[model samples]
Structures are given as C-alpha cells and as structure tokens.
Target: MNEKQFDKIKNGKGFIAALDQSGGSTPKALAAYGVQEDAYANEDEMFNLVHDMRTRIITSPAFDSKYILGAILFEQTMDREIEGMYTADYLAEKKEIVPFLKVDKGLAEEANGVQLMKPITNLDELLKRANERHIFGTKMRSVIKEPNEEGIRAIVDQQFEVGKQIIAAGLIPIIEPEVDINSSGKKECEQLLKKEILKHLDQLQDTENVMLKLTIPTEANVYKELIDHPRVVRVVALSGGYSTVIANEKLKENEGLIASFSRALSQDLNANQTDEEFNDTLEKAVQSIYEASI
Candidate 1:
C-alpha cells in the first residue's frame, strides 16, 4: 500500500467521489447530466460519453484534494487516460486525491432476501492492473433488501471473503453491503447488518484493515462502533438514492461517517453548463459534503 495514500484515507477530512457508475447506471447518470440517450449510438459511444463527463468533473478546479479525499472509479475509467496520463496516476500524482477501483462485476439475483456480488472471474488480473496504475484500493458491493439474518450474514461473509483476497493482493477493500432504503424493515435490516459486520470484523487479524461504505443508518450515529473499530480504516456513507440535501442532513447526524456519493454529488450538475457554472455547482456539492463529513 502507498503509506501516504493510506494515511490520507485513514485521516482525510473530506468525502470520496463515487464516479464508478457502470453498465445500467451509466445511462441514468448521463441523463441526469443532461445527456439524452439518443446522443450515443452504441455501448462504446455510451462509455466514451460517460468518460467525458467524468473527465470534466475530475479536471474541474472545484474538484481538488482540499475538499475531496478520494474517488471510486469504474473499471472502464480505470483503463482510460486523462490529461495524457492514466486516470489513477492523474488522481494521485497530479490532483492529490487517492483513487480506488470498483472491482465487483455487479450483483447476483436476489436470493434469501439479498443480492450478493457476482463472481469476479478476473479479480487477480484486475488487482494487478490496479497496482500498476497507482490505485490505492478497491470497492465491491452487495445489497440487502430485508431483515433476514441469514441473508445479511451471507452478504457480510462474502464481502469479508473477497475483502481478504483484496488485502492479500495488497490493496485495502471497501466492503459495501447496502441495505435498500425503502425496505419495510429498514431499521431492522440495519441492526442485522451491524451485528453481522461486527462478527466478521472481530475475526480479522490486526493487520487486516478494511474500509466500509454503508447506507446511512435509519438512526443517528448507529455505526459509531464501526467507525471506531481497530480493523476499520474508515466508514463512509452511500447516498442510496437520497437527494444531496437529505443525504447531507443525515450525514451530519452521524459524526464519523463520510460521504461516497454518486447521484447526490452530481444532482446539481449539467453537461450543458459552462465551465464556470459547472465548477460553481461542483464546488457547492464538494463543500457541503466536506462540511457534513468533518
């Protein structure tokens, strides 16, 4: 691990930018940025357009390390170049922001009330490339839709299993087991998730630290223990479909959890905006999220 990068993520005051929208989520992200579906004819064109959007955001003056600690990038974006350098290098060397790669293929079909991560057939190869490209760590996700203890346990187990692999490969893993915000048993689900996560975290060795990206708890500071765990590097909150205002409001209620927002961060931005307007919008989002995080 890059010790400087590790220290930054461990103690940074700002939030991570989730620019890792992939496959199905890309179109929705583009539409929110004012790019219509008709603008791209094929998958390649679609990826190119989204990459351009990411490039704009990454290069914006408002997207600086003073208010942004790190960024989570899609696999396609990781392989691409920006400002004549690999994207990860640009983030770490030029912008002073740590870079993490999204490593999961996506989720499996919901079973036992949860959607576990699909198998990552090429994770080793991906990790090799990530290290070569100066990536600091990786993020993978699974989802829980109910308070089924069995399902939540399975999700945490799988996350830890893969997270161990990431650790062995010399990268910190951001384990994300997201609970659906609209679940009828949302609070119960959060409780079950907390219990399961604690069980796994207790089993880790002293050297095996991992990050967590969780849904904002239904109650304030419910994850304070996770935030303070010796085996936890940092605990961040996902926007989970909430608007920026709502997400930040809930985030402030939790003293330690910071933001790793995708939709909420970009909600106010538009592809049609001038550079100055875009920067101003991004600056507001960055500053607000930074304040809530700190």
Candidate 2:
C-alpha cells in the first residue's frame, strides 16, 4: 500500500461491515431488510449481494470517500466454481474495494482439558484459496484466535507463515486476534488481552500493514491505553455479539478508525425493501460510526 492509501485508511472514520451470507439461512429479520431470500440459498446469490453491497457503500455519501468496504467470504461461498467465478467477476469489476477472505474453519472449542481452535491445518490449501482470491482483486483477512494464550499463538504463527505467502503473492493480510467478549470482564482482562496481542505483534519479524480486531474495552481508559500502543498500526473495533444499534453506539463512544461488524448487520436484514434498502441501511450504520468517530 502507498502512503496515500495508508493515510486514507488511518484517518478514515468508519467501520468495515461484514455480511456472512455464505451458507447459513438468511435470518428472517435480515430478509425483512430487503435481502433476497435466495441470496443465502446459493453461492451465486451471495456473490451478487456482495457486489451490490459494495457498490452501494462506495456510492453512498454517508460512507467517507476514504473509508473502505470489506466483504467476508465464507467456506460455502468459495467452494464451487460458479460462485468463485461470480466473486472474481464482481471483484474485477470493482478493483478499488478491499475484499477480505476469512480463513478460520470454525469457532474454537475446549477439548481434552485444553483450549483448542480449528486451525488452518492445510497450509497449501489455504495458499491456493488465497491465491484465487487475489486473482479476484481481493486480499486475505484471517482470524487467528478467539481468546486464549494457545489460540493466540496458533493465530500468530498462522499469520506469520501466511503473511509471508500472501506478500509473496502480492496481497495484503488483515491479522486479527479476536478477543471473545464471553471471556472478557472488566479493565484487568482488557489489559491482559492488550498485552498478549502486543506480544504477538512483537514476534512478527516481517509483518506489514497488519490490522487488529479487538472488542471495544468496556472501560474508556483501557480502550485509550490499548489504542495508544505504538506497535498497533490500525485498530478495528469488534461489534461484539450484540445488536447493531448497541454496536453503533459503542463505536460512536469509542475512539477508533475501523470497526469490524458482522452479526449485527446480518441480523437486521428484512425482506420488505429491495436490495437497495438493505445496502442503504448498511451505509447508514457505517456512516453513523464515521460521524461518531469524528
């Protein structure tokens, strides 16, 4: 990325909204928000929705010109040839939009008296998929851990290894060490999480243009402390597992540039309006965060 590009992202005040329209049934609430029911039925509909959403966000005045729109591609969306072609076509058509590829197989779980995460056990497969995504004008965004030391190490290692491959392939990697709100408590937990995250960053010898996804600390003081870290290039606040309204309010109250919001936006979709309405609401929500940041 060039200096101009870096500044645009660093100074921009908005969140990167994610719609997991990959496989699971589209929520009824989201269907009511104008999302096509068929969109979630197959990969074709999902890809179209991705393109439609991107175009809508970029063209909207609510989202700043410098802000970036990211789409999350899941396992179901990337499994077939037709869906991949659609994704590539959409990405090629919109070269400027930042596309993110989700790498984790699934959520982490506890087993055998040890916290375990579904790791990207196949490095070659991951590389191949990432290369395909690159061909479609999208970069890779991998989530490393949920909220544990072991999980964090696994994520950092994967990021370090994948970062090398992605850079060699001429792509950007969005490194995320997501802290689970379920395991998080007050200020002390936030501090420990920040410390662990920073430790991981320190271990990345050649890491470049890395982004951190963290739950917005419940305490403003902790949030400020974490944001002030010198090693943290960009901070994208997580929307927590809550409503977009609440997430938007938190983003508004917090001081951060990029917000990674997924579940809230997807859960709000209603089928009453057209695709345009769904996109409009998303843009509005993002703009609310941008304005709040300013």
Candidate 3:
C-alpha cells in the first residue's frame, strides 16, 4: 500500500470521482454524454468510445487532485493508456490523484430482496494487475432493495470475505452495499445494513482495514458510528440515482460522509460541448462536491 495515498484518502478535503462505469453501464453513460446507440457498431468500439470519454474527463484541468482525491476506474481503463501513460499511472504519477479499480463482475439476480455480487473469477490476477498498474485500492458493489436481515447479512458477509482476499493481495477494499433509494423501506434497509456491516467490521484484525461506500441514508448522519469506527478508514456516500443538487444537499447534512458520484458528477457534460464549455461544467460539479465533502 502507498502510505501517501492512504493519508490522502483518510484526510483529503475532496471527493472521489466515480468514473468506473463498466460494460453493462457504458451505453447509458455514453447516452448521457450525447453519444447514441448508433455511434458504435460493436462492443470493442463501444469500449473505445467510452475510453475516449474517460480520457477527456481525466485530462481535463478540472478533474485533478485539487477538488478530487481519487478516481475509480473500470478494469479496461486501468489497462488502457492516457496521453502515452497507462491510465492508472497517469492518474497517480502526473495528476497526483489516487487510482482505484472496480473489481466486481456486476451483480447477481435479486434473491431475498438483495442483489449480491456475481462471482469474481481469477480475482487474484486482477488485483495483481491493478497493483502493477499503480492502483491504490479496489471497489466492489452489492445492492439491497429492502430490509431483509438474512439478505443484508449475506451481502456483508460476501463483501468482507472478498475484502480479506483483497487485503491479502495488498490493496484496500471499498465494500459497497448500496440500498436502492426508491425502495419502500429505505431507512429500514440502511439500518439493517449498518448493523450487518458493524458485525463484520468487529471481526477484522488490528492490521486489517477497509473503506465503506454506502448509499446516502434517508436519515442524515445515521452512519456516524461507522464513520468513527476504528476499523474503518473512511466512509463515502454514493449518489445512488439522486440528482447532483439533491445529493449535495443531503451530503452536507451528513457531517462526515464524502461523495463518490458517477452520473451526478458528469450529468452536465455533453460530447457536443466545446472544450471551454465542458471544462466549465466539470469545474462547477467538482467544486460543489468538494465543498460538500469538506
């Protein structure tokens, strides 16, 4: 682990930028960026287009370490290049931003009101490559749709189980158990999630630590205990379908949770915009999230 990067994540005054949209999410992300379905003929071409999109965002002046502490990258992005350097290398060495890789293979079909992560085949190989490419950590996600204790317990158990593997491979894991905001019992879901998470956290050894990326709870500061947990490095909040403005408002209401936003962060950017316009829009988004984080 990189001590400097760890310090930055633990004490930095900025938010993480979630640019880690994968194969399943690339189309929607591109559509929002003004690229249509007809823009690419095949999956490879589609990935190329999305890579170019990510490249633009990474190279933009507004997307640096000033208001951004870290960036989460898709596996492909970590493998690709940006301005003649590998993407993760560029982010860490030149841009001074910590780089994280999204390591999950998407989610499984919902069962018991939760969607657990699909099995990650050859995870050790992926983690080795991420470390070789200068990545600082890894993020994996599972989703909760309701407050089923059995389902939530399973999700957290799966996360910590995989997290231990990541730790063995010398990377911090950001375990995300997202609660669907539109669910009928959102608050109950968060409450159950918190309980499950604390139970798992208690089992970790002194040398082991992990980050938590949670949905912004329906009740502000409900995660205060998690934020102060000795085993937790930092607690971040995902945008989770909320608009940027609303996400920011709720984020400010929570004292310590910081933002790790994807759609909300890039919603204002369109491929049709000129360089000046794109940068201006990104500046505003970064500034708002940064202010809310601090």
All candidates: TM-score: 0.99, 0.68, 0.99
Instruction: Give the lDDT of residue 47 in candidate 1.
Output: 99
Model 3 Cα lDDT, one tens digit per residue, 91-121 = 9988999999999999999999999999999
Residue by residue across 130-160, what tens digits does model 1's lDDT show?
Answer: 9888889999999999899999999999999
* Every model: Cα RMSD to truth: 0.7, 5.2, 0.6
User: For residues 145-246, what per-residue lDDT tens digits would candidate 2 score against the true structure?
Assistant: 234445455555655565555545544555554545565333444565566656666665564445566666666535565466654456776666757777
Q: Candidate 2 at 21: error in angstroms?
A: 5.0
User: For model 3, what is the error of residue 115's alpha carbon versus the real structure, in angstroms, after optimal superposition?
Assistant: 0.4
TM-score for candidate 2, please give it: 0.68
TM-score of 1: 0.99
- Model 3 CA lDDT for position 49: 96
Which of the two, 2 or 3, has more TM-score?
A: 3
